[model samples]
Target: MAQLSDDCFAFGGPMMSVDDAVGLIAARVSAVQERESISLHEADGRILANDIAAPLPLPPFTNSAVDGYAVRGSDLPLQAEAVFPVTGRVQAGGSAQAPLQAGHAMRIFTGAPMPVGADTVFMQEDVRLDGNGRVVVPAGLRPGANVRPAGEDVAAGHPALKAGQRLRPQDVALLAAFGLPHVDVRRRIRVAVFSTGNELVSPGDRRGDAQLFDSNRFMLGALLARLGCEVSDLGIIGDDRAALAGSLEQVGRSHDLILTSGGVSTGEEDHVKAAVERAGTLVLWRMAIKPGRPVAMGIIGGTPLVGLPGNPVASFVTFVHVVRPTVLALSGAAQEPLLPMPLRAAFTYKKKIARREYVRVNLRQAPDGVLEATKFPREGAGLLSSLVDTDGLVELGEEVTRVELGQTVGFLSYASLM
Candidate 1:
C-alpha cells in the first residue's frame, strides 16, 4: 500500500457546493503505485496501468464483409447484366486457389480473405446463378463495395487501450482481439467501512427495545464492492469517543480509506467529529445538498476518512457524489462524469435555492409517448423503500427553486450511480 500525506486533504470552508466538494477530492488525492498483471478473464472493471498498442491490424488481412461473389473492379458490367464463370471458391478460414482471373468470379463466404486481384464483391442475394455454373453480374456495382480492407477497424501500432481506463466487457473483447492474454492493472483499493451509533446492532444480533439493525454498513459494502474495492467490514461501533478514536487509528494503518455513516452530525451523541480529530485531522463539511448536508472528511495516520449522514438515503446520495470520485482517484482510473437524461416532470416540486437536491422518482412514458418523471410520495431520508421502489432520482440544480408540471428535468438512473 502507498501512504498519503497526513495533511493532504487539510482544507476548510463553509457549506461547500456539490461540485466544489467533488473537485477538491479530485485535485488532492493521488493513485496508488502498486500494479499487477492479471489474466484477461479477470480484467473487467479493473483500471489499466499501462497503455496497450495494437500489435497488428484487426482481422489481420483484407476479407469479405459478406458471403458473396468476389470479382475485380474492372470486370464489373458497365450498362447491362453480364455473366462470368465461377471458377474458384473460398470460405472462412480458407483461401482462393489463385488470384481471380479477369472476367471471372469467385464464390466467397463472410470473413474469407479476398483474392489478391479482387477489390469488390456482389452479394449472393443480389446476383443470380445461371444454369451453366456462372454468376450473373449486375450493372453499376461500385468498386470496393462489400469488402473490408485491412486495418479498417484499428491500425497496427495505434493505441488499443490507454492507461487509467476502467475496462468494460467490450474493452476486454478488444484486448482479446489483439491476442493479449494478460493485462497490467492497478490493484483494488482497500477500504474500511463501519457504522457508528449506540442504538444500532448487526442484523443477526438480538435487537433491544431502543436499538435497530444496522443497514448503512451493508449498503456501503455493496456500493464499495461495485467500485471494485476490497472492503473490510468493521461492523458497528458504540457512541464512545475513546473506542471510536482507537478504531480509526487501527484501521488507518492498513486501509486506504475509512468510511462511516452516522455520528457525524453535531448532536450531543455524535462522537465521530471528536474521535476523528483525536486520531488525526477533521474537516466537517456542511455540503449544500439536501438530505446529505453533514459530511466529515479527515486524514488519520496518512489515510483518508469520510463520515456520512446516518439516514440510508443520505448515505446513498453522498456516496455517489463524494466516495465514488475518491475511489476512482485512488485507483488512478479515468473520471467519467455521470450525465443525466432529460425528461419531463409529471409533478410539481419546490426546494430551497443554493442547495442541490435529489428527489426519488419513477419514470414512465406519458400517453403521448414522452418520458416523464413522477416524484415519490414520501420524502423521508430514512426510508429505504424510496430508493428501492423508484427508478432513479430527479436532480434539481442549486439555482432552481421551483419545478412546474411538464417542465424539463434531468433524470439519473440508479444503474448509472456507480
Candidate 2:
C-alpha cells in the first residue's frame, strides 16, 4: 500500500474553496495499492494496469465492405462494353491469398477478402450476369470502391487503451477485438460507510417522535458501489460519542476509506469530527458553497475519512462533490468526463450576492432550437424532492450581480462528475 503522510490533517478552516479542500485532503496521499489480475468478466469497474496496443490490424487483410464483385480499375472501357470472366468466388471469410490477375473479375461478398490484384468492387445491383459466368461493369466506377483495406479500422502496434482507464462494456469489446479474454485490472478499494444520528431510523423500523429513516447510508453505498468500491456497511450510530468512535475505529481498521454522516458539526451529539481527529487528524471543516456548508475531512488510522452534514441533501451533495473524487483517486481511474454544457437562463431567481449558488432547474427546448433552463419551485437544501424533481443544476457565478431573463449562464448536469 502507498503510505500517506500523517500531517495531512493539520489544516483547519472556516470555509474553504472546493479545489483548496481537495488539495488539502490529497496533499499527503499517494496512489492506491496495486493488485493482481483477474479475468475480464470480473473486472468491470477495476482500473487498467498498463497501456494496451494492437498486436495486429483489426481485419488483418483487405476485404470487401459491401456485397459486390471485384474488378481491376482499367478492366472496363469507358464507352465500349467490356466483359470479364469470373475466375474465383470470395464470400465472407473466403481466401484470396494470391494476387488478382488482369482481365479477370472475382465474385466477392460482404466482409470477404479482396482478391490479389483486384482493386475495385462493383455492387451486384449495378451489374448483370449473362448465361456464361461473367460480370459486366458500368462506366464511372472508381478503383477500391466498397473495399475495406487492411489496418484501416485499427492499425497494428497502435495504442488501444491507456493506463489508468476504467473499463466499460464497450472497452471490453475493444479488448475482445484483440482476442484477449483476460485484461489486467486493479483490485477494488475497500470502503466502510455508516450514518450517525439519534433522530434517524432504519427504513422498516417504526418512526418514533420526529424520527426519519436513514437515506444517507443507501445513497452513499449506491454511489460507492457504482465506483466499484468494496463497501462494508457499518449501520447507524446514535448520539453517543463512544459508540460512534468504536464503530469508526472498527471500520477504519480494514478499509482504505471511511465515510459517515451526521455528528460532524458543532451539535452536542457531533462526534464524527472529534473521533476522526482523535483517530488521526481533521484536514478541513467547511466549504464556501451553498446548500452544503458543513463538509469535513480527516484521516482514521491510515484510511481517509469524510464527515458529511446531517441534512439528506447536504450529505448527498457533499458525497458527490468530495468523497467521489477521493474514491476515484484510490481506484486509479482516468480523469472524469466533461462537465455540463452551459445554457441560457430563462427565468429570474433571487439570491445573496456573495455566496455561490447551484439552483435545480428543468430544461426545455424552445422553438428557436435553443435549450433554456428554468428553476424549480422549491430550493431548500433539506428538501430531497427538489433534487429529485429538477433535471439539472443552474450554476450562478459568484461574480455575477444578478441574472437577466434572456442572459446566458453556466448549467451543470446532475449526472456530471468532472
Candidate 3:
C-alpha cells in the first residue's frame, strides 16, 4: 500500500461527493508491484502483470474453414456442371503432397492446411462425386470462399492480452492456444475483515437478547473473495479503543488492507474512528451518499483501512461502490466501470436534500416488452431483505429533486457488481 499524505483526508473540506471520493482514492492509491508465476488452471480472475503478445499467427497457416474441396478459383467451369479429376486428399495435420493443377480438385477436411496453389474451396455439400471418381463442380462460386487466410484471426507480434487484464475462461483458452502453460500475474491482495460492536455475535453462536449476529464480516469476506483477494476473518472486536487499536496494529503488519464494519460513525460506541486516528491517520470520512454515507478511509500502521456502515444494506452498497475499486487498484488491476443501464421508473420519488441515492428496485417487463423498475415498499438501511428481493439499484443524482413515474433512470444490476 502507498503512503497517503497525512492531509489526504482533509479533502479541501468535508462531505465529499461520490465521484470526487472515488477519483481521489483512485488517484492516490498505487498498485502493489509484487508478481508471481501461476499455471493457467489457477490464473482465473487474476490480473496480468505484463502484456502477452501472440508468438505466431492464430491459425499459424492458411487452412480450410469447412469440409470442402480445394481448387484454383479460375479452374471452375463457367457452365452449370463440370467434371474435375480428384488428384489427392488432405486432412488436418497433414501436408499437401503437390500443388493443385487447373481443372483438378483435392479432397480437404475442415481445419486442414490449404494445398499449394489452391485459392478457393467449395463445401462438399455443394459438389457431387461422379461415377468416374471426379467431382462435379457448380458455377458462381467466388474466390477465397470458405478459406481461413493465414493470420486472419490474429497476427504474429500483435498484443493478444494487455497488462492489468483480469483473465477469464476465454482468455485462458487464448493463452493455451499459444501453448503457454504459465502466466505472470499480480499476487492476490491480502485483506483482514472484522466487525466492531459489543452487541455483535458471530453466526452459529447463541446470541443474547440484546445482541445481533455479525453479518457484515461474512458479506465483506465473500465480496473480497470474489475480487480475488486473500481474506482473513478477524471476527468481531468490542468497542474498547485499546483492543481495537491493538488489532489494527497487529493486522496492519501482515495484511495489505484492513476492512471493518461499524464503529466509524459519531456514536458513543463507535471506537473505530478514534482507534484508527490514534493508530495512524483518517484520510476521509462521511461520503455524501444514501444507504452508505458514514464511510471512513485511511491508513493504519502502514496498511490501508476502510470502515463501512454497520447496516447490512449500507455495508454491501458501500463495499461495491468504494471498496471494490480500492481493492482492484491495490492489486494492480484495471479499474472496471460501473455504468448503469437506463430503465423506466415505475414509481415516483421526492428528495428535498441534495445527496446521491441508490434505491433498491425490482425489474419487471411490462406488457409492451419494456423493462420498468419498481421501488421496494420498505426503505431502511437495516432491512437486508430488501436487497434479497430486488434485482438491482436505481441511482438518483444529487440535483434531482423528484422522479416521476415512467421517467428514465439509471439502474445498476447486482450481477454486474457481485
Candidate 4:
C-alpha cells in the first residue's frame, strides 16, 4: 500500500492547466517501495528495482564480423590488389590456435576469434582466391574495416539497464544476454475500481427501467491492466453518500488507489466529492481542459483516490492524463511522456482559448503520400462511438483558437496511448 500523507495533494487554487496538474502529481507522489524477484519471462512491463551492470564486455572478445580473411594492417595493400598465402582457417566457435605469420592471411568465418597478430579483415565476397591458392585482397580498404573491437558495444561494469526502467521485450533480451535468469522488479500496483450513481447497473445483471449497464468500470480495469496493475472490481455504489463513503474508506485500506467514475461533478446528485471529503482529504480540481473538467483527487487511509467524469470519453481522456502518470509514479517507473505525431489537417475546427482540447480524428494517406487527419463528425462528450470510430486524437494547445485546413497538427495515435 502507498503510505501517503493526508495532505499530499492539497491545492486550493482556482482552475489549473493540464500541465500544472500533471506536474503537481509528478512532484508530490512517491513510488511504492515493495519489490520482488521474478523470472526473466515475467519481467516485461514490470518496473526494475535496481540497475544492472554488464559483467563483461558485449561480444566478450575481439572476433570476425563476417566470413573473411584476417590479416595484419601492415600487410594491407597500399594501392593495388595484393595476394597473400592463407596461413590458417577459423570458423565460429573455433579458436585462432596460432598467430597469423607476417604477410599471410587467415581464413576466418563470421564470429571467429582474431589471431594474435591480425588487426584487419577482408570479406570473402570482397576478395578472391588466386590460381596459386593465395587470398587476393582489394586496395583502399580501410584498416579495421570489418573488425569489431572489444567493448565496442558495451564496456564491462557499465550500466546496461538503469533503475526505474519499465522492462520491455528488448530489455528482457539484454538481461538474457547478461546471463541473468531473474530480475528484481517493483510489485504491481493494486487498484480498487468502482462507479457511482443509481442510473448504472452491472453488465449481465437485470437492468432497471432508467438504469444503464456500467461501462467505465470495465474500461478503467482494462486500462489499469495494460499498465500492469492488479485491479479489484468493487462494483457500482449508489447515490447515497454514507454508503459510498464507507466503501471508499474500507477499500482504501488494502489498495494503492481508489478510482471511481461519475458523481465527481457538483450536481446535487453528485456524492463522490462529499463522500471522499468525509473519508479523507479531497481536492476537487477544475482542470482547464475539455471533456474532463471536474476531476476529484483525494487521499483515503494513506491511499490515493481519483474520481473521473461519468462520460466514457471524458473518463478515457482523463485516465491518459491523470491515472496513467500516477500509476507510473507509484511503480517508480521512468517518466516517458507521449509525443504526438504531426499530420496535415484535412478539416477545419474551432475552440476556446486557454483550454486544451483533444479532437477525435481519422487518419489517412493523401495522394501526395502525406498523412492527413479528418475530424469525427459528431460532437458530444457522451458519444462512445466517436472514440470507437476514430483512430486517435488531434491535440489543440491552449493558445490556438482555430485550426485551418492544410495546416499541420499534432496527432496522438490510440495505439501509442498506453
Which candidate achieves the best TM-score against the true structure?
Answer: 1
lDDT of each: 0.93, 0.77, 0.89, 0.92
Query: Tens-digit lDDT track for model 4 on 1-418?
Result: 8878888788778788989888888888889999999999999999999999998887788989888999999888988999999988998898877889999999998888888999899999999998786989999888887988888888999899999999999999988877899999999999999999899999999999999999999999999998999999999999999999999899999999899999999899999999999999899988988889989999998899999999999999999989999999988998779899999999999999999999999999999999999999998888999989999999999999999999999999987888
| lDDT (Cα) of model 2 | 0.77
Poorest 10 consecutive residues of model 1 by lDDT? 1-10
- After superposing candidate 4, which stretches have Cα over 4 Å from the reference? 130-133
103: Cα error in model 2, Å:
2.1
Q: After superposing candidate 3 on the true structure, give the runs of residues whose Cα lies further than 4 Å from its correct spot.
A: none
lDDT of 3 by residue, 213-268 (tens): 99889989999998999999999999899999999988988888899999878888
Candidates 2 and 4 compared by TM-score, better number? 4
* Candidate 1 local lDDT, 1-418, one digit each (tens): 5466766766666899999888889888889889999999999999999999999998799999999999999999889998999989999999999999999999999999999799999999999998899999889999999999999999999898999999999999999999999999999999999999989999989999999999999999999998889999999999999999999999999999999999999899999999999998888988999879999998988889999999999999999999999999999998879899999999999999999999999999999999999999999899999999999999999999999998999999999997
State the lDDT at 15 in candidate 1: 90
Misplaced by over 4 Å in model 2 are 24-27, 76-82, 97-99, 350-354
Indicate which candidate wins on lDDT: 1
Indicate the residue-level lDDT of 79 in model 1. 97
Pick the winner on lDDT between candidates 1 and 2.
1
Give the Å error, residue 305, model 3: 0.6
Comparing 1 with 4 on TM-score, the higher-scoring candidate is 1
Q: What is the lDDT of residue 218 in candidate 4?
A: 93
